[model samples]
Target: MDLRQLQYLVAVAEEGSVRRAARRLYMAQPPLSQALLRLERDLGVELFTRTSRGVILTDAGRELVGRARDILHQVEDARSAVQATAPDDSATLRIGAVAGPLSAGELTRPILEAFRALHPDVTVRLRDTSFADQVDLVASGVIDVALVRCPVVHDDVDVIPIAAEPRALFVRSTHELASEQTLSVDDVIEYPMLGLDAPEWFSSFWQLDPERGHSLVDTQLPPVSTVQGIQLALAAAPLVVTGCATMARFAPSPLIRAIELPDASPSIIGVAYRRGDTRPVVRSFLEAAASAAAENIALLPNATSSV
Candidate 1:
């Protein structure tokens, strides 16, 4: 009935028990149960079904939960919007980036510096999430901007190309390709190739296949979930993966080498956001990214061969 009650319902739904939700919400189980009972009575419907496993949402509860989450998010967005328009230093920009190249510290440093210089009051919060999640985050108003690989299929979002960078074969220092300055895709494919676990956007660069026997690598690995994983894989095994030239520039290990993949197309990195956002902070950041992209373009190697 009220935001507090709706909050309680959401908490119970997430925690899956009245006792657990009470613990989380800093209330007694009895009060939380009474609140749920009142909510159900006021709505004239049973929201949850009791079961041995846990509390499960009824059909109406399922629909109500979705709407309640939306309403809460909208309220949060309104609060953020008000804060966003305050003095420059009070503004916040939530940035979503896939955890390399653009998301890494080195590449973001200059842009963040420029952003701070331009709008010193604005606080920038960066999130390193998956490219697929970034799209939805932007569309849902969860993040102000997302810097990610191109070929994003979401039509509800607007994308601005930030840079086109070379795709290189990353390998451990002991790997045969480590000493080489350039590599053909065919040459690197001989070793067990470590690849990004992606469906289309990333897979297309390597010309991967869902159908059996059509992939270049003997094994397909999910994207390195952590930066340490990326470093370890490159140090221990021959990881023939594609990365932005900027990412390789920032990695801690000299053990890993970025060899030019002659047959792989360069990855196009860009900024994505909701189509209707007209905020000045968002506009300023986008401009800074565009400027940085222009200055950095010549740093990438040319890919002469096609995939």
Candidate 2:
């Protein structure tokens, strides 16, 4: 009935014990138990099956858990929306993006600059994170807005396509394949492949097989940083990397070249946030990203850029 009851119920369901849940919720066991009882009474259903092994969700409990999580998420969103309206004194916007900026052929400065202009007091903290996990992070109030690659399959979060840039395969200029107009999966398999630090939608397209002659020369390198991946590929044989035109423009190495694979489609880069969050600052940042994305796409390396 009350938010506390729902909160207590969720804690118990997660912790699987009234006593443990109480510890996690920082409350006494008896009161937590009473809250659950009251909730079950109001709902007119048994939510959990109690045992020494800990609580097991009854069919009803399982059903309620999903709704409870949604409810909690909505509550958190509402609270955040309120706080975000009046810019905080901290003036910090915590944003996370898929780590490969140079390889992805995208630039984030336009958005960062626009946001800084409006909220000069607001410092943006950008972290290299996974596109896969970012949706949940935004929905759970972990990050304000996540720069993610499409297509997202979640109903709880909303994604706005900010840019669509071609995916490129980077190789050293001296490599045999580097001179070719385009390359294929088989053509580059024999060489050591440098992969991104995090998985994007395009990762599945490569489909490298270890048993089928494509051996991983190194796995110990940090797979998340684009800079690191490029560095590793430069040192190794036949490094297969992906990026866009924007990346090639800013690349530090003259030896590195971006080549387009006719089969490799352009990846969709987007801004993602909680579906229901209506904060003005968040909205302003989204607009800025959209605007910057439109201009930056033109700068990204196209499939036709001289490799």
Candidate 3:
């Protein structure tokens, strides 16, 4: 019925639990519950169905939550637009990037340069984050935009597909698979796999072990948190790491060998930002990213070979 009520509804929908939503909003549970009940009464529809785990949105709830987010984002954008008139308002654009192969200079630098060329007055800040944290960071307003790998699942964020890079398997040169020119997902899974500390959906796409239903937590090798950690694990053990071919080509170690996986799906690179973010600078950056991606893709090798 009102912005406050809409906020409550959206929060509950996102958190999927009244208690958690109330905690996030720094409000009492009783008032939040009362508010939702009043909203359901006014709308004459049950917004959520309570379950043992948490709550699930009904059809009406889903529709309302989608519009509510758009409205809230518009309100924030209106406030920001008015505030932009003040002389002291800073012109800094904060960007979050997942620390991995695609975050390398070869892919990111051109986009940065293109954005800078267009918006000379704006100062750009880059924050290095994990794949799991990128969507949350954008939704919470910690960053204006993010460059990440798919599949990102969040209703409050919008992802734009940029490019798809071929997948490859990284193994120690001493490993048996290292000498092989190409491999299949079945072949790579036999060795101890090096897993990254990333979100399940994000990591699953790169692992290509869905047929066996393998999980990174079940990996024999210890999980790594960064690209450097992955590199170290590869050099120290015969563990296999799977990722984009572009990343393997960038590896510094001669001891590491990257073998293509012809049967595996390519890793997708995408740009994401908060849904309904209508800022001019944000729009400009996205355009620049698109242009940069097109240019970069042209330079990429057509087929993945030994690296």
How far out, in Å, is residue 266 in model 2?
0.2
Q: Give the TM-score of candidate 2.
A: 0.54
List pairs with backbone clashes in candidate 3.
none
TM-scores for candidates 1 onward, in order: 0.57, 0.54, 0.67
lDDT of model 3, residue 13: 99
lDDT of 1 by residue, 190-233 (tens): 55655554434344343322212345553545555344566676
**RMSD, candidate 1, Å:** 14.0
Ten residues in sequence with the least summed lDDT for candidate 2: 204-213
TM-score of 3: 0.67
Off by over 4 Å in 3: 1-90, 216-220, 303-307
Give the per-residue lDDT of model 3 (tens digit) for 120-153. Answer: 9999989987756877898888898998766665
Candidate 3: residue 157 lDDT (0-100): 70
Cα error of candidate 1 at position 255, Å:
4.5
Q: Best-fitting candidate, measured by TM-score?
A: 3
Model 2 local distance difference test score:
0.63
